[model samples]
Target: MPDLVAIASPGRRRQIIIRSAASCSPLGGALARAGILVLPAPPPGRREGSPAGEGTTNMGLQPPQGSCRGGVPWGAWGTVCTALCCADGLVYALGGMGPDTAPQAQVRVYEPRQDCWLSLPSMPTPCYGASTFLHGNKIYVLGGRQGKLPVTAFEAFDLEARTWTRHPSLPSRRAFAGCAMAEGSVFSLGGLQQPGPHNFYSRPHFVNTVETFDLEHGSWTKLPRGLRMRDKRADFVVGALGGHIVAVGGLGNQPCPLGSAEGFSLARRRWEVLPTMPTARCSCSSLQAGPRLFVIGGVAQGPSQAVEALCLRDGV
Candidate 1:
């Protein structure tokens, strides 16, 4: 089962493993058992060899280690459905549902230098189940639930202006969707939808629609079938890697969480199946720290403190 390490890579560890396997090591057998056929290491004084269309790195298989309190502070109550982003060397914890089951518009920023979270101006719309992505000096909040149904409202918070401005709304409303910014565009991926009369899709099924918004053009276009995600997932973690958009661990057609993952190659315009997450959970938070992507804190059987990451590259 130890060999399953390759199969059970959470996020950051998988990235490290993919890059760290530059040369053959004693771990070859275990990796082989995991179904990974590693290429022989490059000769000394030579560049490392990797899969075709892949780049070289110098990372290791070491996993991320550390923990922080889940709760924000005495005055700031903790809640689910939160979104996070980094700007100007600070982390922003965005809107989420409060204990009353009402979506909150509160915005809080964490200062590492001060080791505390401070409040910012509230969002124009109170939302839950929304996904956030940073582009330039602004933070874009995508589709999320306003009440029992999904919301199409799209808005951006300008870091420099300290204000929220309405942006083009989503063509189709969705909640709990996975989102990421790559190549000057914002992608809104799969999530759950409410069934309505006259609609063909029934039972509140998961959506496979993939839409991308051009930041410069201010337009949204749905990706073709060939470019869609391999899996229909909601509440999953998503991040940009090697110019690819990777989706990991979320709810699917099953009752339990999914451990599966996939990545969309910008170069090839195809979805590549990646290793499944070590754990499966919903409503978890994902963030990019430098070249690594992290999934932290969510519900599996119950509240979870588990933290996982993927180094997008070997050296960086």
Candidate 2:
């Protein structure tokens, strides 16, 4: 009865898999409501690309039900937050909105071994939808929205030290920006540059600017003007693959969502246009496994169920 499940994706290296939460009951009647069931475990020595048996871990306790199901503990439950699985197999939940729609500074971690969540030191900045990247023991959180407006607060949490660190804020205010790690740096890509003190009378607009936070230098560096993304977009799905940062479909200046895709090469130090997505979309959920970056359900004309992936091999 486990809600969250990780399974090996088919036809790939078989070493990497995608973890997703279960959303529906297979049997939709009284049998489904029994509140008790068994989930088979993956058979030992099973071949890759094979289907996984219906499975749930037997923690010796019934899976949580009702609103409590898939819900975070009291301190970390809210919308527009980021939940990321680190190399240590722990789920780290970062800044999000609280019940009153106010931003929260709280940080929490889910311990699957004990089937419980533990609170951690709160972040110095309170905001939701911040882009986060895990580098070594530090989790860097970048710009996120505060209510309808965007904030430039940048922060990080040290997993080993059990402490929080405030880094230099983003040089500019950007909402829906994409964050990725490449070549020992945290790269922040295009987004809607909102109006600020310098542009109070101007309306929010999309930008193609790119910036990077060097892990070694410990400072933010704006890429040269020529290195900016070719397309002006916000809320794009971005991931680092094959020594390049790939930006998938997202909202652009057009009335419809964008389908164009582009990649920024770390070695080349410039943006290059790539193959367009089969389906145009924005605000899509993304997952990276090995060389493939999966772009899942997102808005098109309406709510969409499209799923597509971009793969990189030998710098192709």
Candidate 3:
């Protein structure tokens, strides 16, 4: 049986609980204590020596002390940054809001082998909540916000050259959009479209606009009107799976969060409704592993402990 390694937090302490993926039965002892809130997924290709249902030592990801920018606590780097593991197994932290709530242009890379962080060239556009993708040899950063206002900046960082290159900005400004790459194209999905200078008095609203940046063509193209997402959503979990783009729970036009899910088939060129998510929430962290898209902790009334995965139906 395959073992599932679950990262759990009980009280203020973090623990790793390993168990059978099929049974999910507790292996007993102190490791099986209750109040496990969230599950932070291990990087893909990680392996364990223990058999299924055997708990491992209590381990957590903690940056080396005095290793962050200016020797500040790693937690001091405020939330809302783009952190992703590259092909080299190194973690890269890109533009985000600083402790003072100002947008930052800093870029830092963490080497797990050495257990230390090192700085790289700063990004050309300094913003937070940007959509990023690791595509062959470069990391593409798309639309992001500056002090609650969206910017059209699009840039890329060359991993080999260690330099930043400016690309064509987004066709329109959007915040909290979902982005994923498939078949040599970068797809930008639903988000909240804020009002511009011409309509500054208008309220911000959710949009279902869909656009794609063709890497080979070096340009952006908006999908046809009929091909847009069925639901206007923002802060959702999206990923590419089985020749389709799946979008999970997020904030819609309603007072409560949306539980609806849908998938856009690249071959069919239309969005198909999927089963509703078990938990209705927004602002969740997501990670794509093979055919599974894991949506982790988010808000459901308040902070939610729900960790759910949206998988494709059998036989596609």
* lDDT scores of the candidates, listed in order: 0.65, 0.67, 0.67
Model 1: weakest 10-residue lDDT segment is 1-10
lDDT tens digits, residue span 150-212, model 3: 868888899899999998888877888888888898889989998877986888889999999
Clashing residue pairs, backbone N/CA/C < 3 A, model 1: 11-309, 11-310, 12-309, 12-310
Instruction: Give the true-structure RMSD of model 3.
Output: 9.8
- lDDT by residue (125-205, candidate 2, tens digit) is 888777776777778778888888887877878878888877788888889988888888888999999888776699989
lDDT of 1: 0.65
Q: Which residue runs does candidate 1 get wrong by more than 4 Å?
A: 1-75, 78-80, 112-119, 196-201, 301-306, 311-316
Query: Of the pair 2 and 3, which is ahead by TM-score?
Result: 2
TM per prediction: 0.69, 0.77, 0.76
Evaluation by lDDT, superior candidate among 1 and 2: 2
lDDT of 2 at 6: 31
lDDT, candidate 2, equals 0.67
